[model samples]
Target: MNLLDPDQKHRLFWLLQAGGWAGWALSFYLGATVWGDPPDNYGFYVPIIAAVGMALTLGLRWAYRLTWDMRFVARVLPFLLGSYFAGVLWMVARTFIFFSLFPEQKAAFGIESSAEFYSYLEGAISAAWVMFGWSALYFGIKYYILLQDAKARALTAASVANEAQLKMLRYQLNPHFLFNTLNAISTLVLDKDTNLASDMINKLSRFLRHSLETDPMTQITVDQEVAALKLYLDIEQVRFGSRLEVLFSINPEVKHALVPSLILQPLVENAIKYGISQSVKGGAIGISAHKDGDDLQLIISDNGPGLDFSQGITPKGSGVGLENCRERLKALYGRSQSLKLGPTLPHGLTVTINIPFSQEA
Candidate 1:
């Protein structure tokens, strides 16, 4: 639809030109043959006239383009008027050629004197309609193409803005994540637990390196996501010891399913922050992935006091981890993906995500 898109515009131009001109020629041929008793030579002359008109319109198409480029209104009106005047001249030339080729046909149309040539010019009024029709078509197509180009540009700008926002949200996780981990390491150092602090630091380095190497926009397999989550949990396990129990019941068939990289991390982080970390005896966190028809379903849940939505109280109070996850999912999948929060059995919080099942990242 875009005029700047050469292949689409070029194809449409040829189709309309061929169809319009061919219809004009066929209508003329039928009108003369079926409605009147004309000379047999018209069989040859009529097609020639149609060919000439089509060729002339091609030139007018170029003139229209030039007119469109003119900035001054004064120049535009004069150029268009000049093109219409040229169309009248073209009819004059066509009439002369027809009569000169078959002088015998002049008598048939009742042309007997020089003064009578003016009568032949009267038919030029009909040719004027054809010329005006070509002009209308040219302008109409150009207007439509301009609108399509504008729409395409607008969509491109919106896509760029969404990408920038997604990057900002993804990077936001880094500083927040680093602050908490470093604080834990500092606590260990203060307690004189050098060996545990050293282990946590090593695991933290590996987790940060993995996160940095992958682009925020890129997707990864569920298996890769689980491995990253385990590295993250290992660092936390050093802090919580046997208090933090991690369980994963991922379906083997769904392990290769594609998902946004680090998408599950924020969900798991939320579980730890609001569920496991708040409990005296700590809690167990469960992660699962399965294929449901054409969708990939992922769930992260914990065994801690869940939110009471019946009382209109949801534990998500501008939580950066949960909010980041939600925004990232929206950016990636628009309306096709989903994120849901609910209570788990007995008493716990659960986060569920659904995205289109695909093998490619």
Candidate 2:
């Protein structure tokens, strides 16, 4: 199925070679019949000439292949000389075949003597032009193919880099979350709350397991991503207890919409860390998703201290998580996706994400 495969390329080359020569023979025959006086057995002669031209060009192809890696300037001389010689050889073969097929025509033209090579001169010049045309077309096609190959390589490299960047961003969340969770667990252990500490460790294990199992390069359904988010939130819930409140308002229609794995985790973590933890009476975190025209709109907001742009664009302690989400979205969807931060209601920060809505087949 891959036309670029070596065997397929060879097959394609032969197909083009056979087709081009066949077309040339047909065109030559038609032009002679319609635009000029037809010679005896001319139909037979044209095919022979076409076949000879194809054979000669095959030699030109071999020669050109040898110089394929050479610079343009270096290739020019070989192309010119090879085409010229091939053209002259083609004409020589055509003249011999023509004379053999219609012996009377040579006598009628008063060129019975083989020593006088002038008879082949005009034909050779015309044949050289034909070969030159073929050579030009061949090189043009080769240049186009090389350009396509280069473009394919560049795209592949970009895809690899994009995946690496996404993985780096994705994996960054784990250690950041893990460090915070472990610190919380350590505090509980120091306070002699073994029961609470054990429960937190169990939740942390499940969250880490899910995180490690999921591939950053793969996408998960909104429902699946939310489930994973809950695993992380479960750990935080244990730590926060009644001090933290979580809410979900996911639309049923968009539940199965595909999104990058753990895309919302860092955002939610930022909300909890910077928003709820900052307040004496911890604020409620709201997560919602719905279809917005052609896009899936996901919003995570917190009723904690809102961002102060006077400080800078990034909220204090929220830059890494927000920037990670932003870069991952850009890597996944380029400009087709967007993440925006704004004030929520009377207080706190709201992050909105818009991505093209898609589902698995």
C-alpha displacement of 212 in model 2, angstroms? 2.2
After the best TM-score superposition of candidate 1, give how far the Cα of residue 124 lies from its true spot, in angstroms: 4.0
Q: Count the backbone clashes (under 3 Å) in each candidate.
A: 0, 0
For model 1, what is the alpha-carbon lDDT of residue 293?
Answer: 83
**Residue 310 error for model 2, in Å?**
7.0
TM-score of 1: 0.83
Cα lDDT tens digits, model 1, 63-141, are: 6666676776854673467557657866876788788778888888798988798877875656777777777777778
The CA lDDT at 239 in model 2 is: 85
Clashing pairs in 2: none
Q: Report RMSD (Å) for each prediction in the order shown.
A: 3.7, 2.5
Q: After superposition, how far is residue 78 of candidate 1 from its true place, in Å?
A: 6.7
* lDDT scores in order: 0.84, 0.88
Q: For each candidate, what TM-score against the reference?
A: 0.83, 0.91
Which 10-residue window in model 2 sums to the lowest lDDT? 309-318
